[model samples]
Target: MLAQTNLPQVAHGAPYLSVVVPIYNEEESIPHLYTRLQEALDELAKPYEVLAIDDGSRDQSFHLLRELAQQDGRWRVVRFRRNFGQTAGFAAGFARARGEWVVTIDADLQNDPRDIRMLLAKAEEGFDVVSGWRAKRQDPFLNRRLPSQLANGLISWATGVRLHDYGCSLKVYRAAVVKQIELYGELHRFIPAIASWQGVEVAELPVNHEARKYGTSKYGIGRTTRVVLDLITVRFLLSYSTRPMQVFGAVGLLFSGLGGALLAYLAYIRLFMGSPLADRPLLLLAVLLVVLGVQLLGMGLLGELVTRVYYEGRQRPIYVVREELNIE
Candidate 1:
């Protein structure tokens, strides 16, 4: 189990909302980000904190985060052992969050912090997850925006969540909803899909998009491929995920039965019609079917074993502490 960062437990004066920001090599954006976030918080009329997770950034991000956290009691920082990607960063932030409503936004200024109120307003309308949709994005035509459109379309079809931008990082999920979602890999992109699968009321609102003013884009063509792959994962988990054995075992049995029936027919032909079983094309076909059937059966067994032994052991993760914050 990996040790999780602990924010001071909610004692008294608990915040009304939490904004989770995941930073990885976004050193250039911290100063501006902090100012914008503060401006947004001041307008909210509710006590809120900024929970920033430094995903083992190999840059000046941690220093800047510490400076910001020290400057304002409302800002808290969590540093990971290494680069754990956005999903892990999100987990760290969400684990330490103590707000009634939690908003997740990217470190890049592309997701305007000023739009937090829009999401909060949607949340007040009884939506569990209010995702931000960038109606007119300010990214390059080919590399970012086009691929995102294609991926979002495919995900909407697969998950039945009709949203214009599933890849948008600006989303407001109830703190309880955020705590319920278990994240890994690039699954952050599919938060709305997963939440909807868990019977959460999901909705989206168009938000402002800004051109990058600091660093280059973190995403590229590789991320687009990963998004497509994760879409398949989300669909699989939604439909037949709970019973792993059923899916693999049924396929295995189907192949095995086909193989057995073919061999039985070949045997009957050899006995009744005097068809020679040796050096025949039908016999070769039967052998191939049997081999394929065995492979599928083996795969099914392996899937069951892996699911029980490996995944079960990964349920608890605890991290050693360097320093504790806010919690008694």
Candidate 2:
């Protein structure tokens, strides 16, 4: 778990809300971001805490965060030793959060803090996850916006959870829903899809997006490859994470069956038709497919063994219980 930087626990019990802001290099926007966020949070008149995660910023961002933590008890800072990306920052914040509901926002000021109310309103209607839709995004089309559109579409199609803007930082989740997610890589944006495995209801709301005013964008085309690879991972976790043999075993069977059929036909031809298979390419193809299929089957068996051993050794429950009946 990532340690908190410079604040003690302010309350005895959990707060009503925990807002997580992952900061990188936004030194210039810290003052205005803090003021506006404070105003918005205070307007709700609810017990809340802010988790400001500085992802090892080389700028004066952590210095500004430390100052804010000193001024207000609600503001808490978690400073990483080095840059580990936004996903790690969010993971660290979630671990330290003690609120009924959690909201994630960016420190770059592109995400509107005032829109927090809208996400809460949507969540009040019994949604486990409420995502912000930046319908009118304010970024360059070629570099930023275009790749985002393609990635969002691909992810939605792959995960069976559709949303207009997965790139939006403004999202709300129930504490229980988020606590179950095991964050790694750049999977922070895929929270809605990841939580869907537990049968969560998801909703989307149109939110405000502002152009960058202070610092440069952290995202680039280089991250597209990572996002695509994680998309494949999310799909696998959704479909066959619990039962690994289903996928690999099915493919392996198909390949092995086809190869066996070809080999049987060649053997019969060689015996009855007196055909020489010494120079034939079909024999080589059949032998290669059989070997590949056996290797795939072996991998599937290993995965199954690992999964079983992991669950048994940890003594962990395989299911999540949202509530219990009187019978219990």
- Which whole-number lDDT from 0 to 100 does residue 6 have in model 2? 47
Model 2: residues with Cα > 4 Å off, grouped in runs: 1-12, 309-328
Once model 1 is optimally superposed onto the true structure by TM-score, how far is the C-alpha of residue 258 displaced, in angstroms?
1.7
Mind giving the per-residue lDDT tens digits that candidate 2 earns over 51-128?
A: 888887899988877777766677778777777789988887787788889999998889999999889988978999
Q: What's the alpha carbon RMSD for model 1?
A: 5.0
Question: How many clashes does each candidate structure show, in the order listed?
Answer: 7, 0
Model 2 lowest lDDT segment of ten: 319-328
TM-score per candidate, in order? 0.89, 0.91
Strongest candidate by lDDT: 2
**Model 1 over residues 1-328: C-alpha lDDT tens digits?**
1122333334347789988998889889988898888788789889888888887778898888876655666787887777778888788778889999999999889999889998999899999999999999999989888888888888899999889998889999998887877777688888888877668999889999999999877778888777778788888777766666677777767777877898999889888999888878877777787777777778777777876775577555332223334432
lDDT of 1: 0.81
